[model samples]
Target: MTDNKRFLLRRRPEGAPVETDFELVSDAIPAPPAGGFVLHNHFASLDPAQRGWMDDAPSYMPPIALDDPVRATTVGQVHASDHPDYAPGDWVMGLNAIEEYSVVVPDGFTAKVDVSAVDSPSRFLSAFGAVGLTAYFGLLEVAKPQPGETVLVSGAAGAVGSVVGQIAKIHGCRTVGIAGGPDKCARLVERYGYDAAVDYRGKSAEQLADAIREVTPDGANIVFENVGGTVFDAELMNLAKHARIVLCGLISEYNSETKHGARNLWQVLAQEATLHGYLISAYVDRFAEGGAQMAKWIASGEVVMDEDIQHGIDNAYPAFMRLFSGANTGKLILALD
Candidate 1:
């Protein structure tokens, strides 16, 4: 019998995960039931949320238990099937573990997709999957950007940020993206259509806030927060009247030993800004609606997918580490085959 390699959570991570936090093991493929599908995995989605998933905390989803196969969002090709809805050779994306193969149930997961229509199959996990959905419902549904408003997006050159900035620009909002370096800042403006991009590498939180205020003189109308730490505190101090803050992620504090709390959250009341945090899975029923619109924009060249895929599944740990260090340019993902 052939063995499938999978990554499992050995113990709760102390801070940033090292190889010891996970254990790679080979397992035999189990027999499929009468109506299940067996898939040979290809790509796995590495997200900052996965860090929270490893911790035993009250979150949008349950945390992975010790000795459990590490939970993740992944895409793969069907190798065998018993369900009438699927067949061999069909490409699919869904919530699965980081493994070489998986037995997917028809319920509680997304069906197979046609990857040829988009830039890459990996985009299903990115611009068209969780990232796109996060950008869509968070920015459009939650923030409700109006024309001529100033929108500030943190982690603005990363996976969800790239999409959020583009969507804001599409709505005719003055978009400002905050990233780590100059190259990412440039790409945010030149490629993703942000009105301005700020590099936060050498600047202090206060200086970054000043730069944001400079780009948005009237104060930020919307703050799409992906990195929550001192940045969120600074952004809180610059909110316009009745502004909206959509809390998408907080990668900055993901691996922190001592969690940082928002000190300037009182500014929400002072600035008359509303802060809302949500998970994309909460809006799963409306995915088709958002996906179709995003697809149309992408097809019309209105939205672009800028994915940064690492070469192999073995690179999953390293690729995941990149998110913490701000090493990736766009959607950070792994390609196994």
Candidate 2:
């Protein structure tokens, strides 16, 4: 058998991920076991959480073992099958490694999408994958938002944050998004139905805080916190009484050499604000319920799944880095042959 190409985690990183930390190596596609199959990978997801996976630290999900193919959620069509449940031509989604093809150890992969309905199978890797599910459960369950409350979402134009703001809107909240630039801010309001949007570039922390507060003078009642660090501190000081802060992603601090802490936590105590950090994987039990709801929203056009897909799998590292640069307007994906 000839070898195939895969990106392996060469070593743990000191901070931000660099291409050198990952080595692209050729490896063989192992033969499927009695109940397994091979999927011709087409699209692989690039998520901010991948950064956390690169570190050798405790997290909701275990770190990717060194020298192993970097972990990712991927969408592909099965070309060979030995499992009764999944046959040839089946489009499935699951936690797959970074490679052109994958050997599915039957019962190892969870079928998330049929692929036929979406037309574009990559949607499964975006809206219906971890990114979409994360937004759904994080906002609906963790925030437990009420109608008419102001909900502010950081990383507002990205995959999870984009969905979070829209879900808040569906619940009848006044949605505000904080993105990085004018284009993203525009998309947040124009494309995703955010009530307002703020660009945080070239602004002081106080100015950013004021900008966010101006839209919800009484203070935000619900905040879908994605980018932490200074932004977290700013949001903490502007919480409404009994506000719910759903800690989703901390992309801003993900690549920092030293962990950053918020000093304004005292505000939470004073305002009686509730801050809850969630890992979507922990809510796998609710995936069916949440996926059903998201699908309904998608069908009804209440929620939109905006994706930013790059052309090749070799671009995975750059796609992953885009999250920190605020280069993606929605879910970032890498397409393979």
The best candidate in terms of lDDT: 1
Evaluated at residue 67, the lDDT of candidate 1 is 86
> Which parts of model 2 are misplaced by more than 4 Å?
1-3, 106-109
Clashing residue pairs, backbone N/CA/C < 3 A, model 1? none
Cα lDDT, model 1, residue 247: 85
Indicate the worst ten consecutive residues by lDDT in candidate 1: 103-112
What is the C-alpha lDDT profile of model 2 across 99-211, one tens digit per residue?
87788775433674766667588888777777899998888878888889999888898889889888888889999898888988899989999999988888777888888
| Model 1 stretches with alpha carbons more than 4 Å out | none
Candidate 1 lDDT for residue 256: 91
Candidate 2: residue 102 Cα off by (Å) = 1.9
Give the candidate number with the greatest TM-score: 1
